[model samples]
Target: MTKSHDVSVQDFNDEDSNVSSNPTFESVLNARLSRRNILRGSIGSMATAVLGTSVLSACGGGNDEPAPGPVPQFTPIEKLSFAAVAKSLEDKVTVPVGYTASVIYALGDPLRAATADYKNDGTDADFENRAGDHHDGMEWFGLGADGKASLTSVDRGLLAMNHEATTDEKLSSFFLHADGGKSTLPRPAAEVDKEVNIHGISVVEVKKAADGKWSYTKDSAFNFRLTPWSDVELSGPLRGHALAKTKYSPTAVKTRGTINNCGTGKSPWGSFLTGEENWVGYFARGAADDAARGDKSVVALKRYSSVQGGASRHGWETAGTEDKYQRFNNSKTGASADGSDDYRNELNTFGYIVEIDAYDKTKAAKKRSALGRFAHESAVFGKAEAGKPLAVYMGDDSRGEYIYKFVSEAVWDAADASPASRIAAGDKYLDKGKLYVAKFNADGKGQWIELAMSNTAIAAYAAYKFADQADICVNTRLAADAVGATKMDRPEWCSVNPKNGEVYYALTNNSARRVDATGSQVTVDSANPRAYSDVHKAKSSPQLGNSHGHILRLKEDAAGAAATGFSWDVYLFGAEADASTSNINLSNLTGDQDFSSPDGLAFSPSTGICWIQTDDGAYTDVTNCMMLAGLPGAVGDGAKKTLSYTKADGSKLDVDTYVGKAPAADTLKRFLVGSIACEITGLAETPDGKALFVNIQHPGETTAMANIANPSKYTSQWPSNAGYGAGKRPRSATIVITKNDGGRIGS
Candidate 1:
């Protein structure tokens, strides 16, 4: 396939300038291709073919490329003690020297007077209205001295935790039945409504004492829960598109609650943006339904991955065939072509960043369409520059996906903070913006190719015809592909340095990558630098797959949002040093920092500190997943090294690499390790950095439901019985960590 051609350079001032002047594919073919002139080059089949050939050939001939240097090692620091002590016997949060932690809130924790106290034995009938399961990402917002929420206050605050998904089988005892599925049982609408109300987000007011310990107020007025069934509105380009229309809200401009809120983002105006990922898979559709709706195209089928052959995973489909359950189906079942008979447009309602006004509970949530539709991991904004458009970067989370960035149309305004101001800021800045996908070049330099509708190559794509700006925004991935964006290895959560504005992406593990082309192997590229197989037995079962993951970093051009060029490098490579010489442990990682699947990432603005957390099944043997604190220097702070590996065919492949390094003890230290059978995810800090909040998700996950009630049979009883039977079922929770001396974290 040839590389997508770049459009001609023109004056960037035309608001109505079509990135492509022609609307029809035939019109694009008839357009002139002026190679002699730098500004008007047209992209055709030849350009795409050449680009594909170059990419494949570049990976095939490994000898021509320079080899990366040897992995650098770091000193190991003393491991923190793993103590199982707290007010509750089930608590299992860990802390480094001079620090302590406490469980502030947990699954099913009550947030309002309407909800009853949590019955720790899983017998709570009111749990449907309580908090959901598996807390992931979170944020801290301060309440002002005047009793209103303030974005800048440093003391009293509200903690907004995302209740990602649920583990409960029934909404209440009344819904329980002999069969494992919900189809065998029936429940009241009130019960179903409660389940819906508990599945979104939990906002609880928390305050820090003079001693630096954080705790929730018993009757905090700001405490509230935002669930999936709540009413929400749309913002940005495709807000009122025909594809977004639904029965509940015919305008398609309004919908209900957020789902699969994995990672979190905060707007400059002080609101939280929760990303809805893996949402399409939640809906159920009939296999033969798409053909009836005129949306049976292969693209549409693959995009929605309609579950026509099976029922919904969470059993929400059996909640009654009312528009509620029917809305979950992406297949066409109705008689009309007006989207009145079926809920095929439901899939389009999600996948965008759902913005929430944390302070103003009355404001409706808005899904910002300008951010693009994909499996968004998180939306992180760079430090705002006066007169410069705001920069927001996101990762597509799926294997072999691309990272994207959106630059706002409006300049930064420091005075925007209230709910009204926040909405105004989003409308002026996020609604109309330029989106660009990343392309990592061979020479450690990368470029941001604009995926504008005006681009001629996008206008001519045969896969799906692009009509206007709405088409470009809704079908963003296709447009990015048309512009030649580099496919990466599971690009997950992204973090930008507050001081330097450099971007970092967590490229989680890809097991399909191959050392050499075999029928089952995935060919390695520059972006996905590692290819290896592992033989290990997980708690679930024995398996062979790529267990270790890596991190990639890029520096923006001249510290500006408009910069097209950037320098790139591999910040860290995930591996076990004892495994093989070819597996480079660049951080000179000991068993402590040798983590698999680096997921959640955050940087402290006060000290420029970087905290890395893990969500893995690979390195669980060494210990439960852990968290590490690092002081990152820059994109290219380490030396250019070379790496050597042997293919399955007994041939050697070598390539040049860049890996970061620092004193093992001081720079790359394993600050804490979690309890048994848990993944350490999510991180947040107080404004002064005096305290830190960490989440421990699904402890004792390996335990079977049959043995859940027996403490001796379970691998862990964290946050309940640190030693023996604590009666309470294991639940995920947010732990508050603070230093005894009241000093800033990582200081």
Candidate 2:
């Protein structure tokens, strides 16, 4: 059954109407032209007036609501041309006036005693302890006053970054064959071990200069890298599960390093939390393995989709028979029912948020199993209030998944940052919190249904048998499904408003959504808000799935993440505003806010500005994926607006609730655009807001090996473009942005 609601006028009221008092576009342009006294500027001055009039009229009305004031404009401090360097052969990293960046670390960078010096040319023989490939999300933690683990020390800090996954030939030096395809066979035992070690998190200490420049301190005592091979312990709910047991560790209390570490979070007590994403694809399980074990439940089979003898994408099983290498295979070969030696349960070990105390490397990191397992993208925490339950919001980055939140069992204490604190903080707070999955009802309101094992629906699920609360926690997806939680478009990254406690999630995309299929396909729901197939923009890269994603906002009751009920609405939809007015383009976006496949998300605590970064392959025609900054109004600001879309078949598809108007440049603006073939991910801000750190991942990504030698043949050459010739291989780097006059960013 389809449900629809009427738009409300109260939803369009701008919360910042009182403080947003910038000049109109025409006035600003006239002021600049008058100061410059340029003939060309005067000739185009009239065009600006016409556009400004339209924008002013749209934002102004006779209704009781206050009009949105003139849009704020920023004058560039400086536009530093691309630096000319040999490292950046293919791509470019554009910096505004007074800002600069460098490659602090990369794929083959050495991390331990095994590899001392790194050969940036990709000829390193040992990578087991080296930095992993495809660096994604990261965090920066300041050292303490005693030169220990302080959260307030600005001069010295630790940077923990995740290596999401490796691109085929880039998996290792030997994995790439001469034919340009991966060697179907697995590597030797040593090679297998190396791959495991490279697939986790890289933790290093960085020191900042008096002038605000940051660099890695290789000799820092606290600097260390955690990989899949590192021995780690399982904490929280599933610590002693039979599935977690292995010959290497019979207790099941301890496991190994995390894999597919993606979006990250930081603890109030000064620690790092890295999330495991798409971890299920790493194991290979034969379909017959489950049946032979006499465990053929539909739920088990569906959860662990093992159709063939094994599904090892990296061919790690071909390495050796040692449990270390063979554990990647989930096929059952033993006759015993215990299955203690088998890898079938290895898949369960991943998909949890692994917590690492960067200050004390000797401490063992714990996987907070309380947070349900599904392609976890990130964990964002709400502001920590002393003596209040600590709230954390997370996302499962899969099509048609649900968002999750966890409230600590114990109230937060500001004094807990001391060294004497035990795992007690994690044990008392994170381990026993109530895990709630979201359900957006039809009335624009949502409920946080508890997925605890005590819940009857979760306890009686027919799929995988839930023996107890621990089982339900380990199999959180099953628990969430049993309670009929509302499914959403791939919930990727989440950011909470420190100012008002509002939660925002990136609904990346969903291809399974259809307009007709009533049961399986996603229908038009209030939170989802749209159902239409996306059209491909590039002929070579056909956009098959829901590529252009959108953003969702949830306003908790009483302005707190601990609130059980919340109001939700579609904040933005990715579309080429100039495209067809039908299904493909629902949001009437202009060039300013129009973007596709929103991924990484972060909010500036100082400015209360939400920065939305994109990881898109859908709309590459107009420009590469870009980042947009917006001053979001509260959740109900546009709750009553409706949008009408004309479909490809010439029929109309109507949508309700606040998504039709163009944001004034002051409300939302394009802060920056990235270079070609790069995803603008990972953001960190200094405490004083004096410097901003941003990561440029996988530049020159589309370049071929044959073009490696020629700078002109590559797609980008960024930092080195300053004065050198083009065509240097692009090196992924962390950029430091600061105002020339040392003012706060976006201030």
Q: Give the clash count for each candidate.
A: 36, 27
CA displacement after TM-score superposition, residue 733 of candidate 1 (Å): 0.7
Kindly report the root-mean-square deviation of model 2 from the true structure over all alpha carbons. 13.6
In model 2, the runs with Cα more than 4 Å from the true position are 1-90, 112-114, 144-146, 169-182, 188-193, 210-212, 296-298, 304-307, 417-419, 518-520, 533-537, 540-546, 580-588, 643-655, 658-662, 704-731
TM-score for each predicted model, relative to the true structure: 0.83, 0.81
| Candidate 1 Cα lDDT to native | 0.62
Q: Output the worst ten-in-a-row residue range by lDDT, candidate 1.
A: 49-58
Q: Write the per-residue lDDT of candidate 2 for residues 131-249, one digit (tens) a residue.
A: 56667788877664345554444455667888766543333322222223334465655556555666788776666555455556555566677877788888887788776666555
Q: What is the C-alpha lDDT of each candidate?
A: 0.62, 0.61
